[model samples]
Target: MKRAFVPPADALIAFETAARHGSFTRAAEELHLTQGAISKQVRQLEDRLGVELFRRVRQRIVLTDAGRLYLHEIRGPLLDLTAATRQVMSYAGSEDVLNLAVLPTFGTRWLAPRLGDFQKRFPKAGLNISVRLQPFDFGAEPFDGAIHHGDPVWAGAIAEPLFDEEMIPVASKVFRDRHDIATPADLVKAPRLQLSTRPLAWRQWFDQAGVAADTAFQGSRFDQFGMMSEAAINHLGAALLPKFFVRHELAAGRLIRLFDISIAQRSAYYFVYPENRTLRPVVSTFRNWLLEEARTERTDPETMLPS
Candidate 1:
């Protein structure tokens, strides 16, 4: 007969809390227990595990080498357990919820406007959105799917093509008028706004325009398109922005196209989900709806402006 291995849940919890806070008093306050009680629980856990988990340093406590390793190993599982419990509780009286990770700017500026139609189409299905700045492990996180930008190269997920992006040089009217950028060569003189992710954007743009500008590498770098657009609008510099993202600003005359030329991005946006995980009905419905929406947007004359 094989013996079952189970540690004391209460003691483990107490130890984890004390290790995290680095003080039994703080952990006890958080757990709503007496400091002595927390210390006793941790001592019991350490005895059972046959290892010292913490080092008493004056009035404070710090994790030992074994303690740090144990914390690292248990944190993910603890988070998963909590998320799973909350998910079950949430679904007790409601429809199935689909958790999706999306880019902050893209979700706000583009997807947010179309959510009403999605809700109308699937009134019974619930949607949850979280901002995801970069690629992450789908297995570790509780996301059903994600809206990802760049290449379809997520290690464990299936990447479905959303749309390709076309970027163009844009600047505020004030900046454009001040610089008098009549040609691509003249654009080299203006301050260039760079995106941190696309370090080679300016260099590529200059190459495509058949202009040599050593200053392409020098400029204010931003992590998000919204920030870069705002800077451009404030007359900070000229920015290379996706046409769709800046369509509203361009129409409102807040920004001006410095030239008619556009650079087609190599990588397109994608809808990604783990290949090993089963696709729920709600997630499938959302995927289908999103793809159709993208198709409609692509074919619409108003949405597809002339380059």
Candidate 2:
């Protein structure tokens, strides 16, 4: 069997650093190694690869085409490795930490208010939070779990339902009056704002409103709900936003519901964790607490708890 043609870790590090700085001397300073040692490591790497990675231009160095490509490939992975290392280093002794990737707006509006109670319940459980706009492979990323929206179909994970979502059309009061958007059908011609993630949001609302909208899918698009909401407040266009997220805006009159109707979003909110990612007790603890919080937060005549 043939082994991978991977270069030594230190050699790759030296090469990347040198390419970034365009000087072995500067790379050595950053890496805490002598310039001579940096040069030696780079020479050994080039000899092993059988390619000249850099062009020596007087006291400066410039990457060759191959070197540029190699740098591009290795730089991202190297940064990921460094981040993973730092995340692990943050752990103390036998204590467990639950690292989570969360949607920014959800983390703010839905989860932030309840976090204090979670801390009171479990003081020792450490949690690390980072925002991610889109889903990624749970097996590949170093997160313990995520607060995900949509279907319970994360490839290698278990998605526990958090609650359902209903999107209501909203716009600034000024914009609504300007366009005289008194009916859902009026939105067919008015500029519509959309989330790229929910491309069919307007179509779903129009269908429920009993309005046949051919241009429903046509609109300015955004990636996050927060951006779309802000755009709506600034009178960019009418947008369908989660009722749960826009309560404050509606109360403050920053944004007003364009109509009384709302459409069920395509999928439900979920507390998703990789099935085999970790065996830490905090993972289950957090999930249990989160589900309970959801139940309490939406205590209507019909609870929104997972069935």
Candidate 3:
């Protein structure tokens, strides 16, 4: 087997900077090096690659075709390398940190409450949570795992089903009272809030409720459930939301269920991670703990209805 040829890090940095600035002098100023040093480093990189990386157009510099291609290819990897280096350096003696991506509303409402127990059990384990709305490439991102919604279709990942979701239409009590929403059929007359990702949510809800209304899909859209919930609370419109996400609001009477209809969500939440990816002890421990927590959560009533 033949070993891959590696270029000097300094030379690559110099080339990238010079290409970005379009001037060796500007690159040198930014890098805190002399212009001559910058030029020499770029020249060395070009020589090693056996390609002319830049062209002198009057006093300005332009990247050659090879240079542009290389820049495009290396930029992401270089950034990833820098980020990894910084993360490692910052946590020199710290405990293992598990980077988990989660849905914004779920992380805030459901997972956040249970995290304290995880911390108590694994005091030395650090859990870093980031909001991720959709499924993403596990290989590209630094996430150790993600809380994924929908089917277990993320390629190359093992999805451990957490729990199924049931959605219900909810609105501010003022809105419901003002609009005089007596049944699911009356919801069409009231404003209907929509989730940007779930464009067909309201349509599905209408179908389940067995109501046909022209205004089912006419309403403002929100990217996150948190924002949508706030909109519904503010009396902007009735929102079809997961039962778990609105538990507190429902319990507090801030948001009232408009009808006794609850639709089983087509998808469920899952704890997902790459199949072949190595897991740190902390990550593995959290996975096990999370499954147990989900199991211990009180079972939903056969019918979730307004009080």
Best by lDDT: 1
> lDDT per residue, candidate 3, 189-275, as tens digits?
888899887888888889988999878789998888889999999999899998888988988888988787777777888999999
lDDT for each residue of candidate 2 in 120-156, tens digit (9 for 90 to 100): 9888877789998677898777788899987888888
Candidate 1: residue 205 lDDT (0-100): 90
lDDT of 1 by residue, 157-177 (tens): 999988877788998989977
Candidate 3, superposed: residue stretches over 4 Å from native: 1-4, 57-59, 99-101, 128-144, 152-158, 196-200, 203-218, 221-223, 247-256, 273-280, 296-307
Worst 10 contiguous positions by lDDT, candidate 3? 297-306
Give the Cα lDDT of each candidate: 0.86, 0.85, 0.86
Model 2: residue 64 alpha-carbon error in angstroms: 4.3
If both were scored by TM-score, which would come out higher, candidate 2 or candidate 3?
2
Candidate 2 Cα misplacement greater than 4 A, ranges? 1-11, 32-37, 40-52, 64-73, 130-137, 183-189, 210-215, 276-279, 300-307
Per-model TM-score, in order, reads 0.77, 0.80, 0.76
